[model samples]
Target: MQAVYSLPTDVSLASHGLGGFDELPSVDVIVPSFNEDPRTLSECLASIAGQEYGGRLQVYLVDDGSENREALRLVHEAFARDPRFNILLLPQNVGKRKAQIAAIRRSAGDMVLNVDSDTILASDVIRKLVPKMQDAAVGAAMGQLTARNRNDSWLTRLIDMEYWLACNEERAAQARFGAVMCCCGPCVMYRR
Candidate 1:
């Protein structure tokens, strides 16, 4: 993926307390949705709203032409109270990649967090991920992901195991070489 802006390499972690999170930069979260289940989307939004990051943060929810009116209404109602939440409703159905690109173009943050509509993040996710971007050479950082419905079925449990292996083992090996090939789409942070 291409980065939209240059990252600073001179940031120091010593001044700020633990992880230098007090120096967190502005962040914009881009969420792309196309016919997503309303309940799942609500949970995802709630998770984002509950983030404890002290830095400036905004959410851009892109609706890629969802046919379900109820889903659209749910999104509007759930996020209506927050001024930081912005909704972009495309006139026609667009693919996820295109939707994300559109949001990225409009984003005004120092870093962008691209999250899937179905994923729910931990409250400190951004706090943990932002520190990785302090290294100018690192263009992106990704968070660990497990099936949100892992207990719903045996298949989901198997998928959760796969996710663990991918995030813990494979990605860890790649990080040692500074050559991670793919960032998990469920939750990822990028410089600009």
Candidate 2:
């Protein structure tokens, strides 16, 4: 529960952030989904497509043998026109990790971001996150997350707070020592 304030990270924050990174690395976002709601999946993909990063970006949506055939077909057709979004269909029900690994093998991005299929990214998520990876010492970086359905109930609100504290406190404190222990599945960026 305690967030350390004394430890200073090796890197200092830069203004505009565009100048912080020596080079804008190509990013590959891998979204792994099973039988996720069709609407939610669309939203997630849309958010990634809307990112403001001024670098090459690719999205690989791995369908881990979803049972809803019609929904999958609709999503495939929906994003068919965009060259950035590639839908990878699996023959059978492989696990989420396997699905992600499969996409990683086929990608040629300088940085890899793992985003959950149900998570909607902020517009500037990729633009802001990639700078942190400029530090050679950094292993991975995780962004702050709050449940989109946080206002539904008290429990949801509590879960949202947990997400905040985990990122702002625990993860932030750990970053000072270059030992942050999260590449949280919801949103994380690391050099490939």
Candidate 3:
């Protein structure tokens, strides 16, 4: 495979013997799963696969020794149809942080976006986040992460409200001062 080089900003593509980037950015998303809910996992992958960014994007499903081997197989088979989807299965169950580090280590893009198996993303999520990486001091960029629980159960509703508030208010405020402490694994895009 040929090495992919970053486009030079000073020179236009026509003058550099190239055409255009076609909206594609060099970004990679890593999702770590441990006995993840198949329905939710599928939704997460679907959202990623539906990304509108023309840049090369890949979703890495890091399976941390899921006990349900059959479900794992099914998920692997589902994503195997596309070149952009990849599965990295570990022999034993590892904690989320370890799995996250492993995913980061295996990633090959200029930036790495870490997300959970249950989270879904908008098509333009990466497009908006990737641009933030241009700043050297900005180690990471995170966005609103509202939960999509349709259930009317009290606990579920309460959790949704808390999550919504965190994403909308707290996170938004932290973003302004660049004091965002937590990475919020759901929709965080990080510079590699």
What's the TM for model 1? 0.86
**Candidate 1 lDDT over residue span 39-129, tens digit each:** 7788788888988788899999998998985656867666967988988889888899999998998889988999888888877787777
Candidate 2 clashes between residue pairs 3 or more apart in a chain or in different chains: none
List TM-scores for all candidates, in order.
0.86, 0.87, 0.80
Model 2 Cα shift for residue 155 (angstroms)? 1.8
Number of residue pairs clashing in candidate 1, backbone atoms closer than 3 angstroms, sequence gap of 3 or more or interchain: 0
Worst 10 residues of 1 by lDDT: 1-10
Clashing pairs in 1: none
TM-score of decoy 3: 0.80
* Full-model lDDT, candidate 2: 0.78
RMSD of each: 6.3, 5.7, 8.5
Candidate of highest TM-score:
2
**lDDT of residue 37 for candidate 3:** 72
